[model samples]
Structure formats: structure tokens, C-alpha cells
Target chain A: MDENPGLSEQYRTASPWPFFIALSIPLAEAGILFNLFAVAVGGLLLFFGCCAGMLQEAGYVDRPWRSLVVGAVIVLAFGGLLLYADTQVANEAVQLAERGYAVLVAGIILFVGGLLGEVFVDDGEFAV
Target chain B: MQLNGQLALTILMGLFLVGVFAWLTRVENWSGYTPLSSGGSAVSGESGYVSEEKPAGIVRWLTTVDHKDIGLMYGAYGVFAFVVGGLMVILMRTELATPETVLVQPGFYNSLLTSHGITMLFLFGTPIIAAFSNYFIPLIIGADDMAFPRINAIAFWLLPPAALLIWAGFFPIPNLIPAQTAWTMYTPLSAGVGQGNQMNAGVDLMMLGLHLSGVSATMGAINFIATIFTERGEEVTWANLDIFSWTILTQSGLILFAFPLLGSALLMLIADRNLGTTFFAVGEGGGAMLWQHLFWFFGHPEVYILVLPPMGLVSYILPRFAGRRLFGFKFVVYSTLAIGVLSFGVWAHHMFSTGMDPRLRASFMAVSMAIAIPSAVKTFNWITTMWNGNIRLTAPMLYCIGFVSNFIIGGVTGVFLASIPVDLVLHDTYYVVGHFHYIVMGAITFAGMAGIYYWFPLVTGRMYQRSLAKWHFWLWMVGTNITFLAMILLGYGGMPRRYATYLPQFASLHQIATLGAYMLLLGGIIWVWNMVQSYFEGPVVEDGDPWDLEASGLRTVEWDWFDRKLQTKIADGGEEEPVTDGGVVEDESADELDTDE
Candidate 1:
């Protein structure tokens, strides 16, 4: 296991990406109502995947890795859905549809990422 | 805000008067000194009580510093508070028993529920444990007295007024308002708006009183830390310190950090309430989230403070009855420290739904999950201690077993709440109530009972009636489980806590819980009767290792010192010749050997 300093620094480095995604997507989707929800969902999925990766790297958990994989997949899926939703909104027949698709995609990715990250981490050495 | 300014000034004046009076008395040497005594009678010779003896009246209790006297005062006061809090629960249960309100107005019922939660946690649970620790830690550590006896007296004195302030809302004070804010005192709700806003003088008083309680607790923590660090006998080394003392040391350390934060938080709230500060005022540059941050910072550790000593007591006594050394003493000690540190980081899990940054939420979830590791380690050590040993199902052991079972359920449910999504659903619901009570009521209270039973003979020199003790233990175990389990189910079904009346769907569960509460009350009454009767009428038992069949023959310093002291007193004609089962003479000779060494 890494010493406290190393582990803490590593944890710090790994933590910021999730916040970045959460913050950046809203700005990126500004004035583009069709795919806004999808962009938000994709950002959320990326955040969960980062958490899983950090937990694993810190040696704080042992788990199935399914959550991490799922989180990654969700990020990708939500990005695609957001793109599709943006097109739908531009078509103007279903402006709200884009945001709904984004939200659904984001939720799935983050959920899967969290689960996989927890499952794959090696937490035994730090067991109390 | 106008009313709060006046109340705050009044409290400040009262505190200043107390400080001045104490200082003046000390300067003039007009202070009456009361000596520590076994009971009401004064101890003769060098250890004569230091407290001033006055007319055997109300003032005697107010100024007494004798640890035993203070302990009894705490015990009686805690029981009274517990009964009051329990009655509130009973009222809440009755209101929820049907869809309609019965005994009180909705506002009044909310007050009852709020007071009940705060009173149970702060007044009843913590004080009862403090009572035992105050009385026994010195005795068990082989110290003649606490390191700071006068401060100890002051700590006990602080409780009554604080309690009165919290409950004072029940009475009609011409200008005072009972605080309608929940016990957590969430911001904006607690910070009154300028004129035309609803306000209560009672709320301000409660906040001031809470600040006093925090001060008193911090003082007690300092005393405990000093006593363990400096007051241990010359012969006692760190490793040789009894388990109970070790627990006190760690718990005290936690308090040293935890209580001051509470003090500061209360002060900030006071400023906001009275000085027009914007620390917690929503918008206008203050955030409601700040209160959650500050409150939980101290609040989570507060739970550990409540549970740690009881855990220590259980660790101390369980091995004696098991007829073996503790399974992993160092492991238990380390895990305690680990838990104390880990507790600070997990407080944010309580704020999962409060809309903190999601990354912050995830970090909190990870830390919360990590706490389970140390807690699990402690649990494993306990199980290994009891595994395959000569287990005696004594009353104390029964309570210990109950503690383990109840705490496990508490711990498991706590895990469920750690998950962010899960907490989003359960936050502020009855489930949260069930989770805490299981730990506070089940684990801490169970540990308190265990300590009382284990030490009763030593304290009073009399054996409690065994049959009656058994009945009390069984009833309490059943009543505790029944009462809390129903609440857990109700909480899962989305029943909101602190509500006067619930929907009809929750009626059956509420009725069940109320019935269980009656059983709990019955159990408590029986326990009081048992203790009282045993003190006066039970058969006398000579103090020794009363639970005699230990594998290593009671190696702790408390046993060694107590036996040595009892023997010397007999030889010096300070005590009678204790009747030994095997007719062994007192070990006064051991004292001579020690002197020669």
C-alpha cells in the first residue's frame, strides 16, 4: 500500500475530473436545448467512472469491476444519445426529447461506473 | 431577532455571575470543602472529603463535589429526562396510532417530537453513560479521585439548567417562545427574520443552554484526559491500564476535538440570532448549507462519544465472565482510534440529498464506507473473545450480548444509508430514527445496564437479587427490539418523523411501536426497583473478584489494587474482617511487600 501522502495526493488528483465534467457540460450545452439533458447525463457517467478509478487506484475497495465498465459505457451511450437529442430538438417537433434522452443516458453511465469501480478495487490491505 | 437579543443578554449575565461568584469564593477561602465518602457519611483520615458540608438540604446537592454524589445526581436526573422523553415518544406514537391528532395541536406535537429527540440523545443517553463513567472510572482505575474534582462538580451542575432551558418551552413565559425549529436547528428556519417574523424566546434559551452543555462536556473531557494521563498509580504502565480507562482515554480525545466545534457552531448561531450576523442566513451572502456542514462536523462524532465508553465497559466486563483474556486487546484499542478519526470524514453522508457538489458527495460516500472496516474489526475481536470460552450468562453478559446484536443491526442499516441514492430516499424519514435509536438506545443503553450490573456489588457491597436481574434483562432485550424494529419498517414505508399525525397507512405500525414503548417503560421501572431494593435489602457480599472463575485469575490493575486496599483497611482497623468463602485472611501483608519493593 502507498504511504498516506502518496495515497492522499493520488486521491486528490483523481477527484477533480468528476467536478470538471459536472461543471463543463452545462456550459457546453448552453443555448442548445435539444441535447442538453443528454450532455448532462454523459457528464454524470464520466464522473462516476472517475470515482471508481480513484477508489481502485487508492486500494480502498475490492469488487466486480462491473460498475466501472458500466460507467464507461454509460458515458459513451449518453454522449451518443445527447447528439441524437440535439438533432431531434433542431427538428423542433420534440424539443424536450433531447434533454430526457441525455438524463437517461447520464443516469445509467454513472450508476454502472460506480458499481464497477467499487467491485474492482482492492480494499483488503486497508481493512481495519 | 428582537426577543433573541434580550435572551442572549440574560444568559450572558447569568454566566458572568456564576464565574464571579466562584472566583470570589475561591479568593476568600470561604468555600466549604466537602470530602469524598463511601455514602453520606464522611470518610475519616487523610482522604476526608474536600467538599463543604452544609445543612442536609437542597444546597448540599448543588455544591457537592464527591464523585459518587455527583454520579447519583446524574443518574437520577438522567432517569427523569428519559421518562420525559419517553412520554413524548408515547404521545407521538398515539398521534400516529390513527390518522387523526388526539392529545395535542400539530405545533405542540412537533415541539414534543423535537424535544424528545434532543432530550433522549443529549440529556438521557449521554448523561446516563457519563454518570457511570463519573462514578466508576476512578474506582476501576484504582485512583482515589478524578484529576479535576472541582471542575467535575461544575460539569454536573451545568446539566439541570441546560435541561430546564430545553424543556422550558412547555411553560408559558410572558415573552419567551418555545423554539419551533427542529433539534438540528437548520439555518434560515432558526435565524429569525427582522420584525413580523414568528419568534420564540425558548429557542434562544435552548441554544444558549446547549452552548453551556457543550462547555460542560468539554471540561469533563479535559478532566478525563488528565486523569488517565497523570493520575494512574506509579505501578500502572500504559499497557497495564485497565480496558475501561483506555476507552475513557480515547473517548476523551474524541471529545477534545468534537465538543469545541459544537461550541463554536452554537456561538455562530447565537451571533446570527442576536447580532444580525449573516453566517447562516440564506442568500445575502450566507448559505443554509453552512449549518449542515458545521452541525454534522460535530454531530457525527457526538454519536461516537455516546457509544465509545459503553463499548469500553463491555470490552472490560465481557472477558471477566468469559474466563479468558480479551481476544485482541491491541486490536480493540487501535480500532477505537481508527473509528474516532474516520467518524469526522463521514458526516457529509447525512447531507446526501442537500445538494452538495456530487463529487463531494461521492468522496463522503467512500469515507463512510471505509468506517465500516474499523467497526467490523472491533466486532470480530468481540466475537473471538466470546468464542469457545467458558461463557457465563450473567446479567452483565446478557446485556453485552444484547449490545452486540443491536449494534450489528444498527451498523448494517447504517451501511444502507451510506449509499447516496439510498440516503436520498431515507433522509429525514423514520428509518433514520430507527437507525440511531438502535445504536443509542440499544448499544449505549445496553452497555450502561451491563456496567451497572457488573459494578453494583463493588459499589454497594451487596449482591443484587439474581432472579430479578434476569427478568429485567430479558424484558429490556425484548422491549428494545420490538420498539425499534417497527420503526424501521415504518421508516421504509416513507413515514416522515417529527410529524404530529401520519396517514392511516402507518397506524398499525405506530400502534405496535407504542405498545412496545410501554414494555420498555415497564422494564425500566423493574430495573429501578431492583437497584433500589438491592442497595438497601440485598444480601451483603464481601468485595473481591465476585465473578471468581477467571482463566488468568483477574490480572487487571483494578482487581489487584482493590484487593490490596481492602486487605490494608482491615489490618488498620479501618474496615471489618471480610468473610471469605475459603476463610483466607486479608492480604494486608501484600501492602508491606509492595512498600519494601
Candidate 2:
């Protein structure tokens, strides 16, 4: 039987990434608006995770774990830069350190998760 | 660092979603939806290899990326938003009836007014147009589906969260209250500086929701541009591309430019509110007028974004009922493009009363008035198309006629406002309100209805009750003119808008408008009931050309696709297909009967 009933091979049937990607933005926004660190870290993690998943699903990346590792490095660098700015700058209202903390924590969790996936999960083993 | 109940709830919810995402990713069967039945494009035998299994119930809707299914979802979502917006205005109109804040407090009234405008424009207007375009664009252009079907689904899925965020203030949440800022979200006031509840987190949520909507619209626009450019069948060339596709293409261009600016403006405003930025702060070097400059730049084009598609709807649907090809179809297409280009230049005319430079205002005024030329061209073509032809006054035709009638009034009123002198007088008054409502409600919504009724059979595979549809049309016609015209009269009497209270002198006209609102409410009820009852219980359409478009050589591609679907279903013994013999091609070969180019 044909996998996709009516559509061509070029079109995706459905993907779980969009739903997660869409859900992640608002959660992140709500976290920032309300100053909730746990929610903020969780949202950023979900957002980056879904992006990597989407990239791998589209075959843009052979190993999404490598992409995630690269993503974690960038995020960690961004967080480190913000923390460095907080030390040099003196704007009371901006709260650079707090934002940096959230980003750093999310980056650390993503790094650990990606490292594990790199060791254990094989490519194309989880293709939906 | 305080762990509160709300924070805990957010964490738990986030974890649950992550778990669901993980589970869904692990499950294997990600091949498209199984067609549950033999009807509806499943047996059309496109690209070979038919599947006999279809997913049933909620799962089919939640995960399917089919353009047709997604279009139906968009339609349902838009209608639901319409009901929400309508109820908000009904409360507002009832309060305006007595002019003494009889029904609700002033703050809540402000909330309702703001929500109504935003909800109607962003929620109902754009999504409803998407509903039509998504379903029909592929069929008409002879594409398999949208260019990026997953992205199309993603675009739609974004809107639900956007709506929830926009309406979050109305939900029962601590420290959250509906933002009283009007749909414009002008600065200084929208900067959360006032003693009013503008400082609430709800305002931030509203802006974010609005930003999400812009993202969704931009994505959809990109898809339309790609699909129309890359996915059109060989026969459906640019020269003969339907007027509706032309308008969608042009509107997508406008969206591609306009919505990103809106998203940026919204983000800057959000940063200003939360992070102490002075981008829109009055005292800290960023002038409040700068916000208006950025907003109306996108905002003015946003008006055309809401309007041009409906104009396409009327242009495309009108001639079919008039029993003629559209008069000046190329001119209509050109006018659509012309409107898209000129829409950007007229943004500053909205700021004439703000004491901008007179020289600058004059340029804006000239461009504003010049933009009216293309609009007038469209109106003229519609009337000329219907002039001497056999005009069938079906429900859709009545709405199209009403669209032209109301558009003339709206356009003329808007022309006067485009002049610096008149706009200065009517800057924030009831006149501005009446003028836009004429275009938005009287013209745009009327065109939307015409499209809906015209394509009812194609969407639902059933016929709507004709008598009830006519009733819906008349009530809305009489109701719209009454409500909006009284507003014009009140504006003439120097009544201001965005007020919960007014002098007793304006009471009678306000009451008249309220009476008109009641009529519209009744009409809306009839429409919903008729559509619902007709979909499940009404007569199922057997003949493919339900409107008998072939009789005038006016049959288009969608109906041909529908004819094929009906033939396939009949061949599979679902229902016997009836012969459609009454058309201009009656004597011709059956194969050529569906050709209408």
C-alpha cells in the first residue's frame, strides 16, 4: 500500500514538530512575561529540541544530535556573553544575569541530552 | 525565586507536552492520513495507488496536513472567532443604546471595544479568507496540495495559541486583565505608563499574541506565493490565472512586506514595556509618534491585506451570478496589484491630526486619495459586469450587490477623510468608526458571505436552504445599513467614539444603531442554524455543477474537480451520478463540457 494516500512523495503527511514548535513559543513568552525561570528553561529546551527534530526530519542534518550539540554551544556562548555584559553594564531594569541563567541552564540540559543521543540513538532509527 | 501555584502548573504542563511529543515521535506510522471513505478526493485516482483506510474522528483533524482538511479547520476557527467578536460588540452596542453605561462598567466596555476590533480584524477576517484560499487554491491551480503542506498545517496551528494568548486576559488568571488598548495599541498609552490598568501583564500577552498572528499570516503568505508561482498546472498560466488567485498573489506580497514590520513593531513595544527600553517612550528620546509611523506603515497595508481577498471573492463570484465573464478581468487584476503597491504610501494620512508636518501630510493625502482610483476601478467593473446581464439575485448575488453599494459609501466617505481638513475634524470621532465599519462590516463581511454562499456546495457537498439563506441576506442588509448609517448620522452630530457615556442628545441615534445590532444578531443566528442544519440534513448534491455554471460557459476548474470526484464516487457505487445536460456545451462532446476558459 502507498504510504501517503493522496499526496505526492514531496509533501509531508504530518509532523509532530510543528505542534511542539508552536506550543514552545507561547510557553517561553509566558515565562518571560511572568518571570518564571523553570518555565522559561523548559520552553527554550523544547523549542531547540523541536528545531533539531524538524531539521533531521527534513534530512537537513544527518545526525540531529550533532546539530543539537552545535546549538548548545551557541546558546552557551550567548548566555556567557550576556553574563559578561551584566558584569560590565549597570542598567538596573534590564536583568541580564537572570536571562543568562535561564539560557545557560537550558543549554546545559540540551548538551547532556544531545551527548546521550549521540552515544545511543542511531540515525534513521526514530524516523516517523 | 518563589515557587508559586501558577509556576508549578506551567512546569507540569510543559512536562506533559514534552512527554506527548516524545511518545508521538517514537510511534512509527507517520504516513499520511488514511482516507476513511471512497468519496472526497480519495478515489480520484491521482498519482496512482489508492488506499482504503482513513483515520476517523478527532485524530484525523488533529494530525492531518491535507489542504482541504486544513481549510475546513480554518473555516471553523474563523467562524468561532466571529461569534466571539460578535458577542463582544453586541454587549458594546447594548451599552451604547442608553448612552449612560447602563450595562457594564467603563473599563470592561473598553476591553470589549478593543477585543471586538482586534478579534474581528485579525481573527475573523484573515482566517476566513484563508479558509477559502487554502481549500480552493490547490484545486483551482491543479496542485497536489500547498507547496509546503507541513508548513501550511503549522501556519494554522499557530493561530489557536495566538488566539488563546490574545484572549488570555479574559480568562480566569491571577494578575491578568484584558488590555484596554484599542486594536491600534498606540504608544504612551500602550506603553503601560498611564494610571489605568495598562501596566497589567495582560497587555504584554496581547502584544505577543498579535505578534504570533503576524508570524502565522506571514508564513501563510509565503506559502501562497510559492504555491501560486511553482504549483500551478501548465494550463493555468499567468494570463488566465483566475482573478481570485491574482488577488491572493498580490495580497501575499503585501503580507510578506507588511506583517514583518508589524511583528518588529510589536516586539519593540514588548521590549519597551518589559525591559525599560525607550523605543516608544515619550520622554526618553523615542517620540510617541514614531510608533504611529511604524504601525500605520504596516497598518495601512494591513487594511488592504484584509480587504483585497474579499474584493477578489466578489469579482470572481459576481460575474457567475450575473451570467457573464467578469468585465475588465485584467483591469481588476491590475487594480489588485495597484492597490497592493499604493497601500504602503498612504499610511501617514492616518496621522494628519497628530500635528505632523503639513508638507508630509499633503504627500500622504495625495497618495491616499490616489489609491482610491484602483478601488473605484474595481467597483466600476463589478457594476458593469452586472449591468445588462441576466442577474440572478441569489443569496450570494444579493450580498455582492450589497458589497458594491456599501463599498461606494465607504469609499466616498474615506475619500473625504483623506483630505487633511476633513480628517482633522473627524480624526477620532464616530465618523471614523462609521466609515471603517462600512468597509469592514458592510463591504468586507458582505463579500465574505457571498463567497461562502457561492461555494457552499463545493465545501459541504450539500445544499443550503435557499429560503433561509435569503432571509439571512435581507436581515443583514437592512441591519447593516441601519446600524452603520445611524453611526454616520451620530458622527455628523459630533459624537466621539471609544466612550462608554455620551450626552442624551446622541441617545436616539445610538438606540437606532442598537436596534440594527439586534437585527444583525437575529440574522447571524439564522445563518449559523441554516449552515449547521444544511450540512448534515440538507439535500446532498448529486450533480457536480450544482450551480449549473456550464450553461453559460462559466464553469471553472474547481467544479471540474468536483465533477470528477462525483464520477469516481458513483463508479464505486456510493451514489448514482446524474447527467448534467443543461449547459452551453450541451451539443458538444461530454469531455469538453467542463471547459470554461
Query: Considering every candidate listed, which one attains the maximal DockQ?
Result: 2
* Cα distance off (Å), candidate 2, residue B355: 0.7
lDDT of 2 by residue, B562-594 (tens): 777666554545222232111112222232234
Q: What residue pairs clash in candidate 2, if any at all?
A: B34-B54, B35-B54, B36-B54
Query: Model 2 misses residue B267 by how many Å?
Result: 1.1
True contacts kept of each: 0.00, 0.19
* lDDT per residue as tens, model 2, A8-124: 444434455666677777777676556667777777787788778666555455456877787789878977986897787566877878877877988898899899999987545
| C-alpha DockQ of every model | 0.01, 0.27
**Model 1, residue B257: displacement in angstroms?**
1.5
- By summed lDDT, the worst window of 10 consecutive residues in model 2 chain B runs over B580-589
| TM-score for chain B of all predictions | 0.85, 0.92
- What are the RMSDs of all candidates, in order? 21.8, 6.6
